[model samples]
Target chain A: SAVISQKPSRDICQRGTSLTIQCQVDSQVTMMFWYRQQPGQSLTLIATANQGSEATYESGFVIDKFPISRPNLTFSTLTVSNMSPEDSSIYLCSVGVGLNTEAFFGQGTRLTVV
Target chain B: GIQVEQSPPDLILQEGANSTLRCNFSDSVNNLQWFHQNPWGQLINLFYIPSGTKQNGRLSATTVATERYSLLYISSSQTTDSGVYFCAVGGNGNQFYFGTGTSLTVIP
Candidate 1:
């Protein structure tokens, strides 16, 4: 199994500010995914970050609001631009060795917009 | 896109009891994983059973790829087992679709 480390386990930000969450994996992975879990709700896929290529965002999510960067296979960052109260949620990054393997998740960054 | 559903949204059990959690997906998937989210909000991967069964300590999971459903069994539950269990399925796109999760509370 791979180990994932997420930075700034929790953060409090102003409504107009932006918070970027970083995810680091111990091993190189081909695909990294960003997900959001709203308060008391299930998780939703934000985007798929592939190394050396653009990220693929899901429905109702736009790259302008949730910009993602996958500069390399071991690291990825997700920035919540112009944070709002509605944007306050838990963001997590996950990686799997391949389609046949189980994916591992970071501890997650709990963001609170005030 | 695929739909994932989990049954028994909330569950309460006594310590040392046994419980079963289920996950159903609308379509076939190449990846299926079970996770437990603790109170501190950490998503812990419990199993990566895309198909067949696997066991670890007091936890075990079985996924029927042909039927698009999975089952997780926890034997001799403990207070520390209280948390939310989630099931996620992934396809060719490499993005996972998550279920609402089953919340379990084990009382001492």
Candidate 2:
């Protein structure tokens, strides 16, 4: 169980702009995941941020659109590029401790594109 | 990909009432978790019961991996428990398949 803190808890960004959301864990974790939740919708995995390597993007998600960076084990950031209204969603960060252990999530970043 | 399904898309309850949230998965799973998404959108982990039963305070969860289903029981429900409950299942790797969630509203 690690505490995950996410930055820019909320933001109102203009279209065509880009916003980077950061996830910082209190302890080192083996798996750090980024997810997007649309209004009144379920959470969808955007990508799995890997340490010392590029993020593994899920189907229908691309690194060019949502570039992720994990400089170390405790810190990772996901950038939403060329924002649009469709990209407006609550971006969440989740951390996994063990194979069968529960995953902890941050408060989430609520992004609004206008 | 694993399909996670949650029952009773919406629920309304009075304070002190009891309710059950059901989650059914399409495939085998080694790990299962339950989370509560509060009014402001913070995901709070409730349980990690892959199998057997686990209890915490007023809430408890039972997962039968063989049956591919899990149940979350809320006793003496409070207004604070009003929110969406999500059940996610993970297997073989680090990916978690999340259910659409059951939205509950407990009126005072």
Candidate 3:
């Protein structure tokens, strides 16, 4: 299991402002993913951040709204651009070491847009 | 795209009591995991059981891949166990589909 550290545990941002959440893992991981959990809702996958390329976002999610960057194997960042009140959610970063291993998640960044 | 559904969306149990949570998937999967998100919103990995059964302390999980369902058994529940339990399923890809989750409230 990898230890994932996420910054900005909680933040209150004004609408239309952008916030970049950082995720750093202690050990190098092959797969890093970003997820969003709306208030009282299940988590939804935002994108899969590749080590050196653009992220592959899931359906209903696009790069313009949630741009991602994975500069290395152990670090990644997800920026919520042009945010809105509907964008307020708990964003989480997860690291999966292998196909059969458990994916570890960061503490999650709680964002509230006002 | 796989669909994961969890049963008993809301549960209230007494401390020291036992409870069972079920996760059902719509398609075959290569990976399945159980996670507990505490009230503080920290996601804790409880079990990574893709198949068969695995136990840790009072928590046990069994996954029947062919049946397309999994069961998580919590014995002697604690007040600290009050939270949401989520089950995620994935195929050969890195993306996972998460269930709606079971909200458990263990009253002390």
Candidate 4:
């Protein structure tokens, strides 16, 4: 099992502002995933951050909106740029030891745009 | 992308009751896991069964990869069991898709 810690458990940001959420893992991982969970909705994959390379984002999400930085195997950050009311959601970070192994998640950063 | 669906989106169970949650995937998968997200939004790993049955104290899960479905069983449910349960499936890649999730409410 992997242990993941995400910063800013909850935050309220003004519209048009930007906020960065940090994710730290207990061990080094090759890939880190970011997800968004809107109010009363299921989780949606935002992007996959790979160290030493660009992040792979899912459809309906872009780097300009949610840029990711994977500085190393144990740390990554997801920035929500120019936030809006619709962007208010819980952002989570995930990592897996292997492709076929069980994945672990952070406690998640709850961002509320006001 | 593999589509994942979960049945009984919302469940209300009495304390000490037993319940079963199902997860169905559209394609074959090499990884299947069940998670319980508490009210505080912490996802707790429950099982990592990809093709067999596994048990833990009061929780158990069975994944029939060939059948493209998995079942999670909770026996003698407690109030602490009230939360959203999600099943995530992955194919050959590291990308895992999550199900719609089952919101369980265990009343005392």
Listed models, DockQ each: 0.73, 0.72, 0.73, 0.74
Q: In model 2 chain B, where is the ten-residue run with the lowest total lDDT?
A: B88-97
Deviating ranges (above 4 Å) for candidate 3? none
> Ranking under DockQ, best-scoring first?
4, 3, 1, 2
What are the TM values for chain B, all candidates?
Answer: 0.97, 0.98, 0.98, 0.98
Off by over 4 Å in 1: none
Which digits, one per residue and each the tens of the lDDT, describe model 1 over residues B1-108?
899999889999999999999999999898888999999988888987889999999999999999999999999999999999999998874578999999999999
Q: In candidate 1, how many Å is residue B99 off?
A: 0.4
Q: What is the TM-score of each candidate against the true structure?
A: 0.96, 0.97, 0.98, 0.97
Candidate 4 per-residue C-alpha lDDT over A9-84 given as tens digits, one digit per residue, 9 for 90 to 100: 9999999999999999999887789999999888888999989999999999999999999999999999999999
- Checking candidate 2 for backbone clashes, the offending pairs are none
Error of 2 at B10 (Å): 0.3
Model 4 bad stretches (over 4 Å)? none
* lDDT values, one for every candidate: 0.92, 0.94, 0.94, 0.92
